[model samples]
Target chain A: MAKATSSAPPAGSHAAAPINQSLTPDDKIGLYRLMSRIRRFEQVSLQHYQGGKMAGFLHLYIGQESVAVGTISLLGENDHVITAYRDHAHALAVGMGMDECMAELFGKATGCSKGKGGSMHYFEPSKNYWGGHGIVAGQTPLGLGLAYGLKFKKLKGAALCYLGDGAVNQGAFHESLNLAALWSLPVIYIIENNGYSMGTSQSRSSAYPSCLAERAAGYDMDWELFSGEDIYEVRARTQVAIERAHTLSRPAVLEIATYRWEGHSVADANKEKYRTKEEVERFKNEHDPIQRWKRVLIEEGIASEEDLKKIDKEAQKEAEASGDFAKASPYPTPESIFEDVYWEVDNKTDAGQTGRHFFND
Target chain B: MPRRLSYRHALREAFDEELARDPMVVLMGEEVAQYNGAYKVTEGLWDKWGDDRIVDTPISEAGFIGMGIGASMLGVRPVMELMFWSFYTVAWDQIVNNAAMVRYMSGGKINCPIVIRGPANGGTGVGATHSHTPENILANFPGMKCVCPSNAYDAKGLMKAAIRDNDPVMFMESTKLYGEEWDVPSNDELPDGELFIPLGVADVKREGSDITLIAHGRAVITCLKAAEILEAEHGISAEVVDIRTIRPLDEETILESVAKTHRAIYVEENKPFCGVGAQIAYMIQSTIFDELDAPVLRINSLDAPAIYSPPLEAIQLPTPEVVVEKALSIC
Candidate 1:
């Protein structure tokens, strides 16, 4: 429901007008479909990766589907999103096809990045999904810039920049926070604290008495912490933060408590050493984001078990097809390495024609 | 008629003109705005453009530089000022990892049209940390272009070109030459009514047949001085080639000069180990080995950290005396 605002919202208040919290049945079912698709895609991608179909880093987003889908679902037309390397879920959430994404993982010419950017870098400028930045805390400032660009252009949208618990300690992250607050940039920093910065647990890596979001207090920014198990709660709360950014032109910190079931990367052999099997299983059994959302949909009568199963089966088939597509896709040629190094070169501008751009040339 | 303008004002005029022409262009860095830049290169810009366009960031190089890279991706052309190129180390990951790699990593879908400009020389007695010449370090990156302008004319034109180009340009200015005045054609006097020196083009400061003194930035000025002495005393007319753009180098001009002169000496204020001159010397030897009367040589800053003492620091950078001596040895 839209509440007509008599005047500008008081300083530091929620959005001037109340944001609509209602979700249609299609929207809820769509969320379930996206989450299921991401889970299956990740599982199949992992199986292929283990089978030597893919090389390099594969930071799977299993057990953390709700965070990306929940938060990104609330984005408006002008809104943009950027995130760290655990970015497949966000890429899928932003409506990128599984074929290109899996092809990218398999280093194929038909990949999203044409096999240049593997697991860590997926970009779709048309969708306003900036990239899958590999450097920790590197995208934070870029996120701040996305907001800065919006504010400078007089647009009414926010940039949702997602980072992990490990990135919080980076100097760049702190610097980005100060700049965001200082400029009042419309950015929502979504800290998906998955309880580990690689092998080290959150306690060993980050020094916080309560939670990571509390660090925002130093910057005098609004912040909140919540569980990532429920997609509805994720959507409702993220909407408030997005509203705060859109209306007040303020920055915020939304720490969604998430847990990753896989090792930091496929190569991290010490995943078993740092944490026990029981701890991982317990989180999967109790706080699984997909299972919790499944229960909620059933309780709300939005979808029956059979309806959810249909979505799951369809998701599984799509994921399986993507693997086949990746296998069939041709690998990028050796000579094509010189392409896409510069925009001018790609367009064959005067700058590109003048000098020896590539060393090989 | 072309008038005398300091290298500093020429750079300012480029910024002023570009900012006026493109609303997407913005200048941001520490003390760039209200403080008028650390070296006063950005004087009067804040008052003219106001806080929004002329922003003063904190003492966070990694933060603002990375932010500039990000902003550029979204179509905002950010001229990020690093007060000293030495501080580029603080933001190396952002500059090299992000800015340099973004376009290629995105498979040409995105462009980081950012110009990271600051003084990158070691002549002054600013000690080791402050006095780093990193043109070679930056030019090594394929996606990033490096420009080291030696005079007001090249500085103004190259600054404009770097800003307009659709790629990351690492513009390394010299503190020694910022205040030096040179004849720069007014925009109104130009055929196109705007001065834009294209990148990857070399300017022959002084033409000769005896030898070629190839240099960039302040070292170009040094070579010009050495050319005069070589002609007067040694009776050797040396060609001074200002290879303005390091990457996408003007190899044609350098080779043309060397082919005519039959001897070349690559000079720079950077250290000899893997310096910009190292690559130039190698290119000269490898490409035109038979054209040379003598082996290609290099005149670099005395191999050590920039000295703190005033007199020693003066001698530490490539002087006209050293260039003349090196040229005579080769000629």
Candidate 2:
């Protein structure tokens, strides 16, 4: 019943349509600001982790900021979101204020998710960001469901699902993609292919390592593969996918070729174990997304070097303030443990649970 | 006056009522549309509600189950039917990691008001893969509500309650009791909310003073039958407590009964290892050790995978005879 379950996308003129430019200079600068914030956020996040101010695994979205900034810029008010554990950049790019995002990493009460969810699980419902799911490919079906909700409500919104290269091989990921296509769900699934799934490189993990989006043909989904080092490139490719989903209510897949500048997480310091130091240095020195975007901002005259530098300073300062805000915020009181387990009252009423309970001595 | 209905009819009536009551309610699962349902619990729903409401999904448990939870997050009340309880392992991450922890981890920002309902016991000759009493496993999570209805009346009332609940509920039903009829209160006979049984409540099916027989799901019937047998054969008037909700387990009813009767014998269709009865035994013993006349005994299914043979399954699952033996031994 899947209309496009072939490995090769259906032959069409839309596939050959030229990528065009719709971004104004102001908008390009605005995107630069967004990318800059994510850049500073990850940079500060690493500093905080190394300084022993942060606990747990921290997957730095250093070179992968464009994927979140580019994909999230296309989303609207009602469009929902789902992403894997590498979510600080996604959350910040989606307008979950810098303080709240950093405070979440610090486990503060003011943080989104009330500090209950750490780095791997930040959710801001006002922004319609579903969660920061930890399980590999676990969030795929949730995005499929969010799309189903939009379709069920007959609304003009869609769902944007973000995953990593390693997640494409998970059973839930394939199942969700197939169903999203078969049901004509309004969803755009973006893969942040940093070449590695944890310590295992995609070449070692996936049976097919060429382009993860090419696998979308098996599910009858429209697919695209593009380099994400350029913010314009990522934005141009994702806009087409987003529009197709909103207009035709179909599923699309985008695989962005990016690189992780750091080790697997804040916990991993041995960079020479799995990957070469020269390779990491090459990607960082030559193909950095922030540096590439900064050059564009200067060359296009969207902003002068001083304006760009001012924006950069402001983003870094904001990232610093987020750490202070988290440090000043309080933790959840111990007595509140029993709260929020259930709605506590009967449906839509203040009447407490009518079910009988034992008398605790 | 109350009307007679089978367990299947009671469940179908509940679904019809909820669907009519809430426009956001949608029922989706494998074979739920044209083929009715694998168990036919959702029969005729596809035609009445059409494709939008009653969706027949492809054979994908992880995808649809996760979708149900995700839809609930967006204010859609999804009542997903698992063909069998044993299939839940395939969607374990959705249930355990996402559905159960969404509210707690999200800091109560959003809740998944989804209901996952289906047959979840070992009497249908459905072999090892098909048969699993997963009340303990599901109830083990903190933010989950596991409801097991014993009879038709309880099934209808608890089904409505689970739907109305603003949290994720694991609504477990029985394949063997689908055709069994009971005196379920019809719509006109009951007042609004009278037929709605809230979760975390315990129901007393039969009252006695000599001993207490506690159980849940289809095992409640076995407990009642055993109570009758105990009364006639051994002059043991046994009280039967049906645990409607396993997680917010009604600790008061069991403790009160144990205190009054001074003897407790727990029964369950699940395996003995980490079974529902194990918790009941420990809780009762810890709370009322001085009140007990004898040790808190347990009668559970054989600690093995469900067998296909009727005779073997009969021996494997707890029976009236086993309940009687445990009751006598405890008394």
Candidate 3:
């Protein structure tokens, strides 16, 4: 087992530090528990969808669990988070209850968005989770705007904006990067490079497949890349990027290299048509983050096989309970359709009014 | 108490007062600060407020306009100038997609409190690209509030209203009417402390029973002039209504005038097909179909683009003579 080091040596040092490190006992246990929860939650969600218990297109964060849990664990409750449509794991990682998230997937009244937003448009303002914007790269400007608002309010909070690598091709992405850099806004843009935008590979889609961080230089921003499979790497890199964003009130980008075990959506079967089965097996066997963490846990004396079994059992039970709660929750009433589309205060008009107050009527 | 001032001076005064009121408010455009604005509307702002408040950006319309959105998002109230309405094409993305939809698309999480001010319509010999009015294009956007002030009082009141409002406002200033002077009432006559002339409310510039002459922006002057000519020569008394805000659309005021006058003549500086005049005509036809004595007459610019040649440009846009002729024919 590799020992975890407190201080990371320079990249080109004569005595280079080893890449793989066993986490502390507590951290190993925590990592296994979080990954188990995410994996079980997503698997249960998939089963619910297959059973016709869930509605809408569910984009499961199965293979990419570490990226969400690892990075989000470093953020405080006061910090803001915004992401694209592939967002269930993000909502879960940010402390939204499993029942509420499951209810949202089931299109029930008890959902986080009151079942109005469905899968692609979840929002929990109380948690500082901005939204699950479906438009490719649409949330870039909005995330930048949120960072701008933080600066305007003189708050010492930073905003984390997550998007797929596919979203980087959009004009809003470029425009937002330029604007965010120009204004020195406190924002960290995390591009989750899962290698596929729907079905097209990143090589076929992007002109430059080297690293999204390379594009950050055009905006003159500090950038880094991390292996998404390694939770510690993601956590460490994100912490540094987010700390810099908050301290300097400037934007940074962190491109995470991850893979999706499931197909893009529930509709697509994992047939291995795009890539070979051997390739999928190679990643699943060699770089399966969940298994890698378990191995580290065993080496670090974090947990026994019995301890892992107990954690997985608890996760499965919790997921089942959440599914049951979601199933029992009622669908939104007809009148609920009109509500929450726009916020309504007791006596004040919404911002769009020409002159008349909203509640005056 | 009331004092007389030119439309240009009133606009400048509004900018000055708003800047004094809010430390975050800044003005940016080409020649706005150093060259005293494109039309002398910002003559003394540079000297008074210095470079920070009164900014002069490069001719990169897209860049500065985008910067305005960025700055506005950062809690600054930016009043951007586009020299002419025709030049708005260069910055349409920053305006339409970014500024207008940012609030709505963000699920009302943010408000873009920025004002884009510029001269629209042709009367000056600038010709073609510089002369064409593009208010209809801007009015088509859902989240934007479009305001075109014809007189000095409305100019000051509306500019103040826009600067203070929480939404993005497209404030269209007529290049031809900047020199036209009018009586601007003092604080006593103003509505409360807000001083905002409500958007989509038509001002009855002149009252007559013969016909209702509807116009907006620069065309309001043409309509008023035509109304005078009709009263003097043809004995046709025309009630001229200056439609200030185009989006919310004062259909109530217009319908009331059409019901009283029994005939209507809608004039606009844009193209004839599907212009603001067509919208007014549709509203009148739908609501007050029986009240109309004759079909709602629409006098608009030619369907083709405003040509560079003086004669062709003249033919394209509706002049006072054309408004007079159209009104007489309709009567």
Which CAPRI quality tier does the interface of model 2 achieve?
A: medium
In the range B105-164, model 1's lDDT, one tens digit per residue, is 777788899999999988777899999998889988888999999999999999999999
User: lDDT by residue for model 3 over B256-327, one digit each (tens)?
Assistant: 899999999888888877677877788788877999889998888877766777777767778889988888
What residue pairs are clashing in model 3? none
Candidate 3 residue lDDT tens string, A1-361: 0211124434423112122243455755776787888788889989999999866688877888888887787777557888888888888777778888788889888877667566776666667777687767767766775776577667887888899989889876777788777778888889999888877888888886357766887778877776888666677667777777778897888789998888888887654688777877777878888887777677657688898999999999999999999999999898654343222211134333433211111
- Give the TM-score, chain B only, in order for the candidates: 0.98, 0.98, 0.94
Which is the winner by DockQ between candidate 2 and candidate 3?
2
Location of the lowest summed lDDT over 10 successive residues in candidate 3 chain A: A12-21
lDDT per residue as tens, model 2, B1-331: 5589999989998998999999999998888889988878889988898988898888889998998898899999999989887889899999988898888778888789999989998977879999988889998887788999999999999899889878889999999999999998777777784478878789889999999999999999999999999999999999999988897788888999999999988888988888888888989989889998899888888888888998888899889998898888767
In the range A3-44, model 1's lDDT, one tens digit per residue, is 211232343232122332357778878989999999999999
Q: What TM-score goes with each of the models?
A: 0.97, 0.95, 0.81
- The lDDT leader among the candidates is 1
lDDT for A59 in candidate 1 is 97
